[model samples]
Target: MEPGSFWTALIWAIVPMLLLLAAIWWVDRYEKEPLRLLGLALVFGGVLAPAITYALDRAFDIATSLSSQQIVPEPSLGVGTPLVEEVVRGLAILAVFLLVRFEIDDLLDGLVYGGIVGLGFGAAANFVGIWNTPSLGSDTDSSLYTSLISQLNHVFYGAVIGLALAAVRRREFPILLGAIWWVDRYEKEPLRLLGLALLFGGLLAPAIAYALDRAFDIATSLSSQQIVPEPSLGIGTPLVEEVVRGLAILAVFLLVRFEIDDLLDGLVYGGIVGLGFGAAANFVGIWNTPSL
Candidate 1:
């Protein structure tokens, strides 16, 4: 193959693999692993490990070719190259486990990380497979099919490593469960109440701010015209804005007094209200700002 063709085939083969890897990443939606560790795992498993495995596979193939003694039957995939490849991949996973034990939180985390490592391996392997297949007289469709199958195979093998890690963790499951239960029993709050508080606070904050601003302007106008000889406008705007933003929390308190069970709950509700008001004010400011 020409250099351009080789590069194009490699890109085509690797694109789907990357998309699948991204999907695997979303499986651990919350509390993602550190980027550096994940990157390291991909590089080590995908590049370094494959290079080592390739060298070992070549040595095995050379020894088999040179042997004079006749074996009853040639080694099948179940006991031959497939098995060796799995072990080589497993070694990569084992190294990650030993180096970064803290990151392996649960079964799902193991599955995600293991799948990533496998994805790297599959991508490296597919690059070579896609590049070499045309020389072996395989069609483009056949090369694509092989690439897809190889990616799936590697991801599945990587998931097996996750299963093993899960099993290891499960041995102390009872102790872990008991601790979790105790903590949850003490700190549990209804999801519905929290959602309601945040929703009410966010939606009501802007309206409350608007009403207070109108009322303050009217008062200021009245005071300037008749009630006060001098217009005390210096502190009026800041005072009105701060109090108006704060009224959202008061509204929440009136709406769901029972939900605010503790000081921490109050702080959370107040923070949400402030966040909403600030967001609204920011949007208005940006929308009014002149574009360059």
Candidate 2:
């Protein structure tokens, strides 16, 4: 370990873990859980459970080595390591279950918590693995990639264990599974309409706004440089931009009226319009920006 490697390693390790946890938290969006409890679970799985697993694994490894004639033992992927790590993580979940039985209201809840706990463990393990890698250089890139893959593996295995432990109501499984299937089964919007909406919003809207800005430049004391007494680009900008955007939506509505069945349908169309406009505008802005 280098002198200041501790802080560097801690930062790299904790950041990715935090991001992964955030994603898991979002997945449990329908029924948000207590952040404090989840944080604690993270700590238990990352810190406490890993420590317990390490001790048990080392002890078992030593015992097995003494009994068996295996000359070199592979600690990293040894059967003992997975068995011990999972059991320890499962115990952490069990402790939470005993104290907060109500929190596990359904199988979904169990799956989320299980995945979270696993993520915590993965975070710590990833930190250690990455922290120990060769100093930041080309070689470390592969190490970082492997670290992410392993962490995800841990979360997946943890979720599987969680599902196993949860007492699921069989009747609800079909409904829950059907909802996912339904979302996938929905019809997709045409790409041609999407492209047209984007072009209108991005190119046509900007061009119209520029023209209007120049045309409305009323100057009391006109000079070549100060011909257009600096207009409030803010107020008129949004109004012009929105109207142009609305025109795009109106075109879609007229052409594809059948698509707008309800509020959700309208929102879907509106979202497409907004997304296309924003994407094109941003792309152009980035392309035209002086910094670039």
* Alpha-carbon lDDT, every model: 0.59, 0.58
Clashing pairs in 1: none
Score residue 274 of candidate 2 by CA lDDT. Answer: 65
Sliding window of 10 residues with minimal summed lDDT for model 2:
62-71
Tens digits of per-residue lDDT, candidate 2, 128-243, equal: 65554455333234334435556776786676556544543222233323121232235555666656656665666556554654577422111122212224322343355556
Once fitted onto the true fold, the runs of candidate 1 whose alpha carbons sit more than 4 angstroms away are 1-5, 62-78, 136-139, 169-292
How much lDDT does candidate 1 score? 0.59
Question: Per-residue CA lDDT of candidate 1, range 1-292, in tens?
Answer: 3211567457855787779778877877787888887887788668877777667656765211112111223342235656666777888887877676778877666777778788888877766555544343323343344355557768867865754555356542323231222223445546565566566555565565556545655222112212222132334534455555566568777877877676435545665666566666666545645555
Q: How many residue pairs clash in each candidate?
A: 0, 0
Error of 1 at 11 (Å): 1.5
On the 0 to 100 scale, the lDDT of residue 102 in model 1 is 79
